[model samples]
Target: MNPTRRQVLGGTAAVVGGSLAGCLGDPGAAGGDSEGEGVFTSFFTLADFTRHVVGDVAEVQNPIPPGEMGHQYEVGSQAQVDAARSAAFVYLDIPGFQNWALDSAENLRSNHEGVTVTDALANVELREIGSGHEHGDDNHEEDHTEEHEEDTHDGGDFDPHYWTDPVRSATSVRTIGEALAEADPDNAETYRSNTDAYVEELETLDETFESELSERSIDTVVVAGHDSYQYLAARYGFEVHSPVGVSPNAEPGSAEISETIDIVDDNGIDVVLYDTFSSPRLAETIVNESNAEEAVAISSAEGTKQQWLDDGWGYVEQMKELNLPAFKAALKAE
Candidate 1:
């Protein structure tokens, strides 16, 4: 006999414990988990997108606690072991962003006979990290130590924050939908239809971003946090200047900070943008030193659990509410 929904979720809670308990809860208790089939994802944004595509077809599980910055997140051994056994396990294939997932993906596939593993970024074109912001001044070439370069993950060759770009995000949705459909063939049609509708919504969001950003007077956005918006910047034809590279944990040197300040001052930027995951101290420093009048928080779609519950926020909703407005203010868009 198959285990009940409560039994499965309770078992998951017992295995993972601590943060996982709070993150998983009862699978069917809320957020469209009525179907009782398990669809586990590595992070919150992917969880939200999977939930949107699967709807009532499967119970989506996002084991990462809300407000937890994904790049810095380390999954417990027991939790990884348990999660590898899930019916469907979805994760980004990007290294360093979710090192645990990348490290264990192959092992999970080998061990979990029933689990379907999906890489949402399988087809998306990832932006190379060092390609952002080339200063033409004397501060252009700062020699990063070999250790720092390794710490920044693969010499910052690829940006993993593809979800920030709606077009890429839609591709992820399609990838996830196909994976889910293949995993549960019985509900394949439903999954595909839902994905189609969700993709349409994302395409509409892409249109909105293009229309709004094209009217902007300013083309440069200075972020006080890590550089996670390369794909978004590339998509919309805006320059993103940041003190650090992709990982929030990668600390910027004083020279990089000075360069960022110079960029903001030279561009007459009025707003400095900070990501939700990183500290605002750097943003404050940049704003104080530059012509930027204020700092705004932009959601990287990596939200806290309480914020999501309180606001009933989803990926698209967050992009529209937090990210879009922040960009508008930062870029001086009409």
Candidate 2:
């Protein structure tokens, strides 16, 4: 909001832009950056979803550099200017996740009149942190949308990872479709058609997860890694237990580690699942210290891995190829 502060920030971005570009690979050619430039997003999954909805209508750019995790990436000054200059800036609105992005979204709304700003989570129902962590048989409580509408960036009451569920992802897709159409009204029809097709794919993915994991032998999502799978757990009626909490780099207390190990041994959980980006040391410790056969890495789909980028793995690919298998192993699904 302050002119002096903004100029300082933008100047910083211009300085970092060149050097970072060298390490950032080809923005348009690799991973989720479907085209070199057009509609830019906050991170990988959002970029992928934007690409599907935009189709050939717009080139979706990813701001997070190659191999850097979205949460950890420090957004440069140029990224904000780039977003403001683009047709639209689509971003995740979760609090504490990427506050810079949230600020940029607000600036676009207040300062930049022409650029469209879309919050991918706008339509999706949010879950309270640890909403379905209990063993009780119940769906999550309603989202506190109204209460937190004014300060959506405030980091309480809501979990940040809503895209982990395909059903919620459908809502996100439609929101993006609407934003793109708003930004480029002439191609509304094309964006609508593209969005519908993508939503259908998301629906299919939801069905697959439901049917396969509905009657899994294990009803709990036991992980030694990150707890980003709360949505997946809530959707399919599974309790969640992760001693490391929700962060990949979190260090669990000894008691927490002991409890996680106990869950593995007590439930006879075969696979100890870790967030793909996390160090395997903790998971390895859990596996070696408990009855778990091995520690497996499952993606949160927050950022694109280098290998996944090469393989062209997108949201659905991560869900099907990586997540489902890790879940099957952890849940002992037949």
Q: CA lDDT, every prediction? A: 0.69, 0.69
* TM-score: model 2 vs. ground truth: 0.81
What TM-scores do the predictions have?
0.81, 0.81
Give the clash total for candidate 1: 2
Model 1 Cα lDDT, one tens digit per residue, 191-302: 8899999999999999999988888888999988877787788889998988887777778899999999999988889999998777899999998988889989887786
Across residues 77-105, which tens digit of lDDT does each residue of candidate 2 receive? 99888887665677765556777786776
Measured over all alpha carbons after superposition, the RMSD of each candidate to the real structure, in angstroms, is 10.0, 9.1
Model 2, which residues run further than 4 Å from truth?
Answer: 1-37, 133-154
Residue pairs with backbone overlap in model 2 = 13-77, 13-78
Candidate 1: lDDT over CA atoms? 0.69
lDDT of model 2, residue 282 = 87
